[model samples]
Target: MKKSLSLILGLSLCALCVGTSFSQAAATQTVNLAVNSVQKIAITGGVITLTISNGTAGNNTLTPVSDATSTYSITHNSATPLRITANLDAALAAGYQLQIALAPGALMGTSAGTVDISNALAASAVAVVTGIPKGADAGRTITYTFNANASAGILTSTAKTVTLTLTN
Candidate 1:
């Protein structure tokens, strides 16, 4: 069964928790949007983080590219996703081109962006998920995972952050 990882972004916050529940009828089960803002944060600088992790067994792809309907959401708590993934390829793969969308209104680092650690595979990357969202932080470090397959284990970070600097 495919699992989901939830993220609470826009602040110096802890990692987001994600999960998945499969229904026998889920194959054809019509799903809807259910959002709960457990927290919120303002963009003080061109930097934000979303601590995220893969579900058990390290299988984090909510749905396979082959199946496009597989859907998931990244809850920003106080802020919105900026539809960052708005520019992401619906289906991600190994060595495939990624359009990683930074929050539309949110700049690369300030309003909204991500620090790439493909070369510096963090705890999350080592876990084995192919792709990750932006501004992913845990404590003092915000990192994102990339497609680190057996052939290429070291991915490089574009280190794209909010396009502009921010002032709370």
Candidate 2:
């Protein structure tokens, strides 16, 4: 034939120009995502009970005529600044001691009692108050004031268990 039909029409026009140059060539890629920042807290008057009237032997200690307030109603979603601590899962027999404070105004600014947390009940955590100003105020109502000491003779009747924490 005419050179085999001109080499089969030049190999079918070079395979249709290499399949239309890879089908008109095209490619792309791009993706990204990120998010992080969390700190939450919530409290609603855990528990409170005090009945001083038994301190007399030698060192006697019983206070609760003025400072005996308790108020807690917080909710958090924190964005930063925050610090409220208190602990006493056990302890409070020998002599006795419990003098917490944070009722001065509220926001932890300080003033009223001046943030004094003595005895600490026991266990651990005993910060009392801090900056605490980032958000998560919610209902907002934190007032704590409890005083009771007995070292003189150390009577008897005693019970302690307090905890209200939120740190950052």
Candidate 3:
């Protein structure tokens, strides 16, 4: 009987230890997360064409041509305000002019409205959209106007690159 009692006590203690060990079994891991700054800009719509082929009778000044078929979209998360600037790859010749305008989006930025960027360069870019907040502005219209005086007669067909930049 004493042997049987000692065996029963040992079994009970062993069961208790096993249950405690099973209950204490667990694992943990550390997870990390972060978000980086984002700044992006894109242009939509295909190539645009502007031809000056009309003028008033007996008028020395040829009529200006305009095309507004292009659009631009932007996404930025800057803490402070940002701006959109425009420039040409090369300056227009004398008596020829190229102008541009951007329509402002809802709560996006303020439009400069019809800026002459004929001779603008990267170092001296013209600001087309200013006071831009941190968000996405989509489907904003881009207008380009081309003009030439009578003095710049019969200029051969030429291509000029217009560059739009988003900056501080």
* Model 2 TM-score (2 dp): 0.28
lDDT of 2: 0.56
Best by TM-score: 3
- Which candidate leads in lDDT? 3
The CA lDDT of each predicted structure is 0.28, 0.56, 0.90
Candidates sorted by lDDT, best first: 3, 2, 1
- Per-candidate total of colliding backbone pairs: 17, 4, 0
lDDT score, residue 74, model 3?
94
Instruction: Find the 10 residues in a row with the least total lDDT in model 1.
Output: 62-71
- If scored against the real structure, what TM-score would every candidate get? 0.17, 0.28, 0.84
- Tens digits of lDDT, candidate 3, 101-140: 9997978999999999999988889999999999999889
lDDT of 2 by residue, 72-151 (tens): 44444456666667767675554445656554235633322334344454455666656666544543444544445654
lDDT of 1 by residue, 12-54 (tens): 1332222223222244667898975432223222433322222
Give candidate 3's TM-score.
0.84
User: What would you estimate as the lDDT of candidate 1?
Assistant: 0.28
